[model samples]
Target: MNILGILRDGTGKMAVGASVAAFVAATCLAALPARADDVTWTMATHAGGHWLEHGAQGFADKVALYTEGRVKINVAQPGALGSPLTTTQTVKDGIAEAATTWGGHVQGIDKTGAIVGGWPGGLRPEEWFFWVYEDGGLDLIKQWRMEKFGVVSIPCDTGETEIFLHSHKPVRTIEDFKGLRVRTSGAWAEIAAKLGASTVVIPGDEAFSALERGVVDALEWAGPGQNFKSAFHTIAKYIITPGVHYASGLTECIINKDAWDKLSEHDKVMVEVAGRLNLYESYARYGELDIAGWAKLKEAAASGNNEFIKLDDSFIAAAQKASNDWADEQAGNNEWFKKVLESQRATLDKLETWDEFRLPIGGVRE
Candidate 1:
């Protein structure tokens, strides 16, 4: 009683009570588990050996690392969960919590997907990376996916300049592309068709077999980094340079809305962070690999039957016009596509500021 009385002047008593309350709260917090959410979400990807699959595991690992075991990403076996073209559908269907897939593959569902996949005459890897994080590009992608697909979209993997075509014939003119049985996807397919080329939308995994079986005369897959070993060098007579179909490559992670909604804010952030980091890493890793891959292809060409066909500047100019025209047509058909394309173009336009400050005129032309 005396000890209580000693500390119990009304204000002192109030302070003592507050301290007791804080102690109880601290004890309750300490008793709780460390992870607010112990969620392990499954992510679908292309088959095992594919770059998308490689990046899927990398992103998953990064999420686990950032979340400190609170969140785990369960990456599925190659083609076991979804195909390159169907992974987004798998996520939308709730078969997988998320998928790492090219947005262009889903262009059949919505024309805008092609723009998100980094369309022809669009951003390069570095510019795309900058726009995604700094500008409102990421937010726009998230918005579009949620609004249209009922899923969450994260830009997980971004890299590669892309090989123009692994072809059995040389292509240096619009006439060269015309009537050519080529395998490609997304907006490029549409543009190629308009250019009079017969374009088949085959998944990358099947591209090699199709080329071998004469199902398609040529294919445009990743840059030399992956193309060198994709067996294209062995089968194709021509390795076209400066991917005019699409300058940069971008792949998205489509998350099931339910799964994403369940994650704690902290977990959500870690997931986004992991995807963002994966983009930068892929860009750097592939940049280096593509350089070496180019050398490898050249060396292989010296002995093997491969030939590097740099698309004529005039033809590239034609492709650019066609790409811009395709974008305009698609934009007219779909408002979402129009909006996003405008935003992207605006970003590219802003980069024109570099022109004013250029000490030398030696960089990317388009």
Candidate 2:
């Protein structure tokens, strides 16, 4: 028998085959087929930035390191695999193994899922993580995912909730909000309207162009992490800090039911562990990354071309009050909404107390 042919046919040919032929065959097998340990999974996200890249790619790196390179992940950014609108279905259909997408875009398929993931002024990262991991919010999010979206929702980072207002004109207070056309999405759009601002709901990719063309006077994207990539620094001369209107926002890593089912018990556990770890890291990193973005803002301001505004207590209180009222109204419209609100509030009370105690410098009211 030809040595090469024999090597190809036998499972244990490393002993009998010549070293060179065995190496060639091994290379061929490695490239052509996957062993039980050699698994490659693809994950998709809507936004492209160093922050997201690190959070996601960092997770993959840790997974490979932990699993000894047995499991690998390929990260796809910005509709590379599919639109956020279809990412849930894309993953469910096995078009992609996993995805990290904004909840609002998928609200049509699962409104409850979006609310639980992150509604405007929703669960803060610290509180949300405690509620999910220590309390019971994770199970609740998962239940809604299975029941409504037929996917697996892993609550990842709450990326800094610094909902900045980047606008052509300075917005010092609520009075400046009148007749201002702002670009927004999800429940926040309603908040904008109630504040007496006209809102244009456009795909995020089109936001910068719209802002540049003077289509919208104000734009409210999350933090400097995402805003920098959009280059809002160049066009929008003013940025308002401390997003009181939306206390929390969620960026979730979701997996197809079928794909999740294929993960072995141990592998599934690894994914869950890595997800939670990265989620924690993301919260910490948000401050660091946003600070870097702030440096850029400062540079622009120093040049006498732009300005950054810090929202006062009154502004934040007003935004939060409006948001709370909306949440209450939503609950009135849907019984399930009330249940979620109660679950979150109940969980928040416990987490906030524990967090305050843990930090010690902060006071806790119990």
Which candidate should be chosen as best, given lDDT against the real structure?
1
lDDT of each model, Cα atoms only?
Answer: 0.78, 0.69
lDDT for model 2, please: 0.69
Across 104-159, the per-residue lDDT of candidate 1 in tens digits comes to: 87788898989898888789887885578667898899899899889998887886
TM-score of every candidate:
0.86, 0.80
Top candidate by TM-score: 1
Tens-digit lDDT track of model 2 for 129-248? 656665667777778767767889876566677555888987767787789999887777777789888998876777889999999998887677677767897888888777765566
Steric overlap count per candidate: 0, 1
Kindly provide the TM-score of model 2 when superposed on the true structure, using C-alpha atoms: 0.80
Summing lDDT over every window of 10 consecutive residues in candidate 1, give the lowest-scoring window.
1-10
RMSD to native, candidate 2: 11.4
Q: What's the C-alpha lDDT at position 285 in model 2?
A: 79
